[model samples]
Target: MQIARLKTVDLHWSEDGDPDGIAVVFANSLGTDLRLWDKVIPLLPQKGLRLIRFDKRGHGLSSCPAPPYTIDALTDDTEQLLDRLRVKTCIFVGLSIGGIIAQLLASRRPELVKGLVLSNTAAKLGTADMWQERIDRIRKDGIEAMADAILERWFGEEFRRSDEAMAWRNMLTRTPVEGYIGCSEAIAANDLTASTSKLKLPVLGIGGEHDLASPPDLVRATTDLIDGSRYVEIGNAGHLPCVEQPDIYAGHLVRFFKEDLNVGAI
Candidate 1:
């Protein structure tokens, strides 16, 4: 992994495959590191592609600051990451909070984005007051307080019954409370209905059938707002479909990026 210092944050990233190939950057969800995409990345047909995955500021091994981070600031961090990588334009694959960042990236720096795959996310993440209260609770009592609730929302009941589910729960429990809270606030304040219409690049919106965080309806609504965007929903999965149903998720993503989006492979 290589660490680059951006203006507002330090980026931890890894690049694989042909250096000159079409670039595809994968941005992870909140509270998780780049390892969240472990199952999906290898399944991608990256014979002639450059795959980039990174840990966001305040998550994984990256920098962590105090609260009150804005979505725009997160977007700026992404822009700086791309600039440091020397990528003029690339396809962006983002999940959950990462999807919001992708939208802001396309809107703020259209020249840096060639295509987008937004999975389990929304234009405005419809976080209610209750959700805000929960975030506050995590800030005070720590992330452990929200672990059970997050696990319930992120995985199906059947998954929760399995040993694998317990491991996933452990991962969630290890998330930094400050980073999670900062991202929750960003989600609460996000409203991209107007900005999505301005995007002209190819986009694919995906959601899991059992996703409670960003359901199919929410993803459909987001796609509807964007011109020429496509939508796909995977069954038997929750918020992190790419992890739970990686083969299905990656198939749809690979097809969309390669054939539909016209992103050439090396």
Candidate 2:
């Protein structure tokens, strides 16, 4: 229940593994709060891995500012929080719109980001018309109107049929109306092709095989933009691999930080 009061917003954040361990910062997807990383955190090799996760503006207990938040503003919120905590550098992991935020943050402030793990995300998602339509729906009908449609896209048929799917659907419906709208607008405007192409930082892009939002080919194309970035896909998952298949999701992270670079380990 740790809350960091940043200048722009009051960000709700949490940590696990170790305070002095190798820092690994996590940013959740558009609809979810920091709790979205719950399953994935425990599966991580916690030897010396310090995990930092936070709820974005308007999500979870964090203060909701308003609608139409820019990606830069979201990144700035995170940067300010990290600065306040005295976390100078760390590997940045993000999902969905969280991934978009990670890319911009790394590009804008390379000194704070040592590496990147982008999961179930893309450089750009949905067309202007699609986002505008969604924006109109939220403004007119509210988030409850599109919760089912969002769930259908977020999960595969198998998970969609299970009771677990309802919980995720609830997560979406529970999201603040203004926060969801703001982040949707952020995603609509984000296209990291140019910034990502120049990133020299080590990157690993993970996609869910069944993800309709950011398919494997699209995520691979994102990896292709980087100099030596790599890509992988997890089965039995949709938009949120970290939620549906946490073990596989966490395994990739363990290998990257431990085997690949040998940074933080027990």
Candidate 3:
């Protein structure tokens, strides 16, 4: 693990494989760390690729400042990370809140983004008032109160029945309440439909068929707004499809990165 100071925040990241290969940066979901991509990373064929995974400013091992964080701050942190690492351009793969950051990065710094893979996220992630009420409760009462709720939305019924439920539950429970709430605010306020529509790069939108948080319909709708974007829904998974079905998810990603996006037409 290496730390890079960007905008007074110490960003933590882990780099793997050869530096000469194409850079592929993986961003985690809300309240999660780089560990979220553990299963999916190894399944990827690293023949000509360098993998990079990092913890967001307020999540995982990264520094957590006070609340009221904006997407611009997150995008700036990413830019600094790339600049510090000397990574010229990369294929960005982001999930949930990370997907929102990816959109912002691609829109604001298009020259640094080679391709995009967005999973389980919406262009406008404004949930109903009732959901906001729950978020408020989390802000006041703490993330523990909403742990069960988050688990239900994140994992499928079958996975919840298995021992994997406990593992995932532990992951969610360990997340700091402040970090989660700060990111929740960012997600709540994000709207990138217009920005995404203007992008002319190859994009793959992946979603879990049973994802209630960012449902397949919402994912498809977001991708539809993007010109020439492709969509895929993995079966028997929920919000965190990369964890639930890592092999299948990585297979789809490898195909996109190797065959579709690497055609040299762009």
Q: Name the best candidate (by lDDT).
A: 2
Q: What is the lDDT of candidate 2?
A: 0.87
How do the residues 1-266 of candidate 2 rate in per-residue lDDT, one tens digit apiece?
98888887999998898888778999998788888998989887676877899999989889999767999999999999889888988999999888899999999989888889988877887787899999899889988898888887788888889987888878888889999989889888888889988888889999998888888888888877888788899998889888888898988988888665568445
What is the full ranking by TM-score, best candidate first? 2, 1, 3
lDDT of 3 by residue, 15-70 (tens): 87656788999999986799899898888766677899999977888888888777
Residue 212 lDDT in candidate 3: 78
Candidate 2, after superposition: displacement of residue 151 in Å?
0.8
Candidates in order have lDDT scores of 0.85, 0.87, 0.85
RMSD of every candidate to native, in Å, equals 1.4, 1.1, 2.1
Comparing candidate 2 with candidate 3, which one achieves the higher TM-score?
Answer: 2
TM-score per model over all chains? 0.95, 0.97, 0.95
User: Residue 16 error for model 2, in Å?
Assistant: 0.7
Ranking by lDDT: 2, 3, 1
How many residue pairs clash in model 3? 0
List candidate 1 segments past 4 Å from native.
none
Q: Over the full model, what C-alpha lDDT does candidate 3 score relative to the true structure?
A: 0.85
* TM-score of candidate 3 against the unseen true structure: 0.95
Better candidate number, 1 or 2, judged by TM-score:
2
lDDT of 1 by residue, 1-266 (tens): 68988887787888877788788999998878888888887887767778898988778877877777888888888888888889998899989989999999998888888899888998888655865997878878988888888877788888889888877777777777787888788888888878987788889999889998888899989987888888999999999998788999989987897688766643
lDDT of 2 at 22: 78
